[model samples]
Target: MLIILTMVLFALALSTIVMFISSLLSKKTIIDREKSSPFECGFDPKGSARLPFSLRFFLIAIIFLIFDVEITLLLPLVVVTKLTFIKTWVITGTFFLLILLAGLYHEWNQGALDWSS
Candidate 1:
């Protein structure tokens, strides 16, 4: 009981010291307008929210997110292969890849992927 109590006290003291040191170190000695201003989601927080946003840029962002999610979803298949049969793994992976490719092709055909108009 005494050893545990001593350990708990030591941990609390150590953490408090570390936190104090970090707080002291992280303080900004000099403040600037650009550094102080809040920036959010590729847009200036100080700018008018009603400003026109590009539809093409939004579409490209959506496409990037879709492909990023596809990569995350496909990565689990590598780990799952050891847990499942080879035939089942291959079929599922191939089907998923084909679906992703089809969506990409459709987007390309629709000119959503084109940079120059």
Candidate 2:
């Protein structure tokens, strides 16, 4: 136990020393405007680089991600069914499905599922 503790402490101290040395050597003293600005053909930019993103598309994507994760969670239950009793598994699965349905209903009622504005 003493040897393990000593080795862990040694590793921690070594990592700290290496990180300190690397940080000290990596300091940047030069700051130039050309390096910071987006590259153009020796001319100022015409417009902002970032374009506006669609809020509806973002909402749809979030909904897709949430449902995708729920499906993954549900998939594992099929494998576990053989190991457990059928009644318990069915109850658990049904409860989870009810929660997912409730969330879907809430999103629909709130008009988040509607694409047409």
Candidate 3:
């Protein structure tokens, strides 16, 4: 208990010292101007902030998120397979492949994957 307490205190002290030193060494520069505007595209700002975004952008974003999450789920399966001898990895891989293929087919059929449209 004493060792853990000592370690925690040491870590806290170390972190605080590092943070203080970093802040002290950092330059305090805040040059606020037109360049720091929200729309830094150089083009004149137009329309309201509540402008409706493209549905195609949302659709693509959703599809990308779905695939990203699928990849995240696969990472755990992959790590577990490396640690233990399990045939479940094969099943999971096949399931993921099938689902991905189906999603691709669906997207292709719906013309959502096509950018030229």
Superposed Cα deviation of residue 3, candidate 1 (Å): 19
How would you encode candidate 2's per-residue C-alpha lDDT over 1-117 as one tens digit per residue? Answer: 999999999999999999999989875555555467676534446566565667888899899999999999999898888777688888999999999999999999999999998
Model 1 ranges off by over 4 Å: 1-31, 82-85
lDDT for residue 46 in candidate 1, whole number 0-100: 75
Candidate with the larger lDDT of 1 and 2:
1
Residue 38, candidate 3: Cα error in Å is 2.8
Taking the tens digit of each residue's C-alpha lDDT, what string does model 1 give over 1-117?
Answer: 999999999999999999999988885655666688887767888778998888999899999999999999999998888787688888999999999999999999999999897
For every candidate, C-alpha RMSD to the true structure in Å = 4.2, 9.8, 7.8
Candidate 2 worst ten-residue window by lDDT = 40-49
Give each model a TM-score: 0.67, 0.54, 0.58
Measured with C-alpha atoms, the lDDT of residue 52 in candidate 3 is 60
Residue 2 deviation, candidate 2, in Å?
A: 58
lDDT of each: 0.91, 0.86, 0.79
lDDT of 3 by residue, 68-93 (tens): 98888778877787888678787877
**2 against 3, candidate with superior lDDT:** 2
